[model samples]
Target: MSQADNLIQRLFSRRAGSLLPLVLLGVLTGIIASLVMMSFLFLLNATLGGLNGKNLEDFEALTWHWQLGLPLAGSLLLILLYRLTPPACQSVGLAYVLERLQFGQGRIPAANIGFQFVAALIALGSGHSVGREGPTVHLGAGIASQIGQLSGRPPSQLRLLLGCGTAAAISAAFNTPLAGVLFAMEVVLMEYSLLGFAPIIAAAITASALTNGLLGTHAILEPVSLSLASYRELPGLLLTGLWVGLLAALFQRLVLVFIRLPLTSRAVRLLLAGAITGGLALVTPQILGSGYDTINLALSDGLPWPLLLGILAAKLLATAAAIGLGVPGGQIAPTLMLGVCAGSVAGALLPGASDPALYALLGMAAMMSAVLHAPLAAIATVLELSLSAEAMLPAMVVVLGANLLCQHGFHLPSLVITQLRVRGQELQTHPLRTALAQRYLSELADMSLVEWSGEGAPPRSKATALVVKRDQHYYLLNPAQLEQRMAPDTLDALLTPERRLQRLERDMSLLDALRTLQDDTGAGFLVPVRRGRGLVTRARLVHMLTEEGGLY
Candidate 1:
């Protein structure tokens, strides 16, 4: 092998050696992702400002006719874009990224990235009730995937790179570094390790610093100082969690309903969704965009209860229609808006609440936690956004309550996981199974204990297994069983179809390897190490699982 090839092999031969390279790659990924996100935000804001003469989110400032016409035109444009693009290149957003990571080895097509950029620009700028974070995530992960492909990293390491990019994107989007790391762990990667944490944290910190330096902390919700009125408000916090959990469940169900609509034509769906959003916009322009401005108003208690309720209903319906119809925007912004409205309503109705702003902040965390099924990340996001230590206790209580209600009461999973299931990609959520899936087969392969030779006399040692090489194939044999059965002269006679061996790449996961074993009646699998092919037996796997605290 060439020296360069040898070095590449050494770097990624095991998971540990890949960490430094991943960390270095993560720095580059963060910078690139942050820059791309900044450019997208700038272009989107410029386009919206040029059209409406206000901030990108200030769709309410536009005239009634403009508010009604913008979404209709934008939706038609989206339909045209989809019609022009190939179906394979049309998938975008968090669900797409997760699907790719799970099955595509973190390889995102460049065409999809281009499509997402253009589609998101049209959807967000034209006053569609969606956030830009989803597109940003696609962009970041796509860039990282391209980098991994260029570097020729194995799929195992490439997945880590994808997580780094995802973290960077979230950090850049909100300038919440710690929240970004937690989100990547809880939502994107779905598994965590010290090795993975280092790179992801590096990526998030770098991305947050870079974006803050360039854009000066591009947070949508304005910071507010908040505190609980008293211990008496604890019950109110619990009720708020229950209320927001119900709202979150409703929102997720509505989005799923929209996603599973019977209409086969993409154009018809887009048009119908646009018409709904536009009709709603005519009634309440505050629902026309991401609704960040309205969220701010609700947070500061600037809007009355009636207006808050109206904005909440309109925004919820519009966002659900837009996303369900497959608009290329994010659900985060809409969820935040929903939380604000829910909390505002709670504060007005509940007597023990100290301030509406406090409830709004807690409700925001709770709704996000319940809908995304990411309590720690949601709590971190709220603490970072508010910069208030005093809000942590209330935030934790509300987030826990909301999560419990969603999981037990409604039997809801995270929105992304739900969408993935709808698309026929059921992810493994068991802790042991997920942990095993993250580990490579090479990690468990026992090379020193096995002897490799032809199908002849046994090796002069206490070897547990024997590998017989014939022609270009390798077969595994149990020494004790071989002694009981008597010597077989030819390899072909000994290795029957059921005893035939399967070849496993060094990067294939242990869980996947186990699954392969269950599906096929092979003697065992052969894993290629630097020295030679390593044999992994079913007995070995069972032992490992037992040691790891039983099968999942």
Candidate 2:
């Protein structure tokens, strides 16, 4: 078939594929993920509750034997699971999303997910100070990919739906819909467009609805009503946010340090982490199971400074050790513990503070923002959890401050650092080469080969090319073109003087590039080498931009 016919067929096929079906699929994926995660969480909580041999709200003590055995046995199970799984599958959820989006749809190996689920259960049930959200995120996305592959969807769309499932998992886990949607868009997809938004939003909403239905309709954070003594206390909460940001940065750094440790045996590292968590649990049982109860106590003024500080230190070490040991788990809940402790201490120290619960809530946002380097997601989480406009302003201030500090000071994002470590990538001051490569050629090189008309000699009118915008107004090649031809020793041989050159800015979006191509005739025209740099012949230019040619 002719090129014209091929182009027409492809375009028509894309146009005919309805968006509604994808949206519905997203919703379905979200609902299913929500149900699955909720059921898992329920079972975990019920099992843990049964093991506790007492109520959840009360400060009940377990026998020394039980205390030591729970985390130890759980840790052993996690270590065994880690030992069995491959190194590439060690990175749990966020890494999976990033890889699938930037790379392509590939199975995460069924065994990996099974091991993760089992390990997460052991971690949470034994009180390893980890969250269930991370495992569920992997579970949702993995399941969605499997479904898509079975149903024969395109790899690209299937990966997109996988992101939708990830969003659903997070939303259901936290019961915070907006945060889940933003997380999927900002961190997972890394692109904000109408194409992705519809599916992601549908997924997030469906997840939230299903979770609320099962779990009895409660906000995620669920903070107590604080009776404000005075307006003067507001500044202290803001100050608390600053401290929380620093703590978040510290936590991120610690995780990076542990992950970077040169341990030859992954099994040994995991066993060591197991020992650490098991030992810590014996002293302070509160550090186990995501430490949600401990977080509540800290926020509610149940513990003094010394005890809170000890719990903070123990939890930090336990969490970092567990994740770095290569066991599958989420950092989100651990971060919540860090923030709660930080904010609680700040609230305790301040003079005549209105309410520390307010500060503790703000601290969560700040800490998470710093760790994730995603202020928008953190802020959305704060709003969804708090359900208060008054809370939004304070959350925004701390989250922004925390994110800025993390970017400037820490120099490592939590999830990305973990991913890089698992992949054995060197941590350097510069960005990854793959990320840099995407921007260089992909923005400009599209259908560039068709423009190459290998005629013996160019016609007079066609020889001196004309570059035009929409409606066909000619653009000039600037003096650089002339200089290249005049200089004998220069790289002028690489120049395509026979073709018209058009100026393209470095920051032009892909959509804009596509629109420009639609208006131009023949093969695609050349884009400028840089901002304000004029274009060259499409044939040589395309070759230069790509890896196939030596120029790259």
Candidate 3:
């Protein structure tokens, strides 16, 4: 083993009380997950070629192999996978990672991982209309969760480590380390902090190195040449962005609508989705296997105009059906395909048209941004994938625009919306922000009230109580009022039940505390901390909220 690997292994020796152990576990999990994915991918390729007698090119051929052969093969493969694996493994692969986050590390059973791997392989090999990223992501998370469980990490910490595994998988898959790290923070773990950054970055870099060692330097799409026409084209780029964003919105809606068809039999659904993909393949084979060949072909500017729209619609429908049928795969490939189509179509409409290949590259990034709601990652991905200035500059604008449209117009990315739906959370509002607030408040609610501060104090305070008062501009009690109210029965009156008593922590983030306070109608609530705690009067909390713009 290398020094880092050895170091990671040693840290896990004393599994308890150290973050080092979790980091080490993340690295190990990432490496193992990558290897497992590679093996599965290789087997899938071989099976498609050897067992099924279908090569990569066969995926694009207009034949019954995809229509009939794929459905038959996929149905049998799914049946075998379902029979061999547990019932819980049947959902889309990414669902497994989300389940782990909400439940616990041990929630993802080992059998589920094996099932997902096998099922994803079968689906991909059979030419089911799904992407690879989702399966790999789930595989990585399951592996990391297992590692964290073995090392005895807490659920919360393990969740973060799971994010690390997710980051590693993306980095390995796309060779985009920064995007993977950002995705880990933004999507998987849903938090951003120095503490969360370390393990994810380490795991991402480690997995990237390992993946590079195995696969060398080829990306999914070939690098294409791009040249800026002129500053005059900037306005046209903006128009392209608008079109890409709209296409992305349409894509998201289609996926959701199809996936919710409520087909009674999953087997039937798989066959149906396969049949649709096969028919599309019959028309144009370029839509198969991440559409790498078609994307490159489209990028060449030599592709006949007659086939562009048909291929675009076919790939879109195929991917949507593939995922809707509960197949295990990623959405990244489909997202890229959508972008290519959108950009190619948009570019064709422009005067003094640019290279279609350049547009294809831009479309991939723009569509990804819309689907993922991560403009930076999308832009970076295009830059890395194309290595062309023309693709990068326009791609950034397209991604930014698509992200804006998706967030404000459509509300949220499809994955986040799907996750919220699965959790039974309302999607019209910010459910995650509410969940975050609730989690924080729940933790605070469990603590004992230690002290009372802020606002008027009761005339009489108990022996254990620390009374605090706030005047117009100061926190000290009004001495004049205290003296004037100092009656023999003053202490007794202050001790009455009507008087308020609550404890609050000052260090709590205002965002969370405000939400907690809003949920209750009491004058105030008791908050506790390891150190000194104080009461935050209802008025003060309300004032804070008003100033902060509103409750979560």
Best by lDDT: 1
Q: Rank the candidates by TM-score, best first.
A: 1, 3, 2
lDDT of 3 by residue, 1-552 (tens): 467555544566532235565566667766876677567667866876763354353565436554456645776778766766667656547755665565332246677777777777777777666677788778777778777655545445666778888888877777777878887776666567666677788888888888889978647666778865666777777777777888777776777777778787877777777677766776666666666556766776456655777777877888877776666777777778778777877777776556666666777888887877667667776776666765666777667777777778767655545645745753333655524432322222223222223324434433333344322111222233454334545543444322343344333444455565566444555455333444455565556445643322
Candidate 2 regions with alpha-carbon error over 4 angstroms: 1-18, 53-60, 83-91, 105-109, 151-156, 218-223, 226-235, 425-552
RMSD of 3: 8.7
For all predicted structures, in order, the TM-scores are 0.86, 0.72, 0.74
lDDT of each: 0.81, 0.63, 0.64
User: Per-residue lDDT for 115-215 in model 2, tens only?
Assistant: 66676777777766577767877887876666555444544466567778878888888887788888776665555556678888899889988888878
lDDT of 3 at 314: 79
Q: Rank the candidates by lDDT, best first.
A: 1, 3, 2
TM-score between candidate 1 and the true structure: 0.86
lDDT computed for candidate 3:
0.64
- TM-score-wise, the better of 2 and 3 is 3
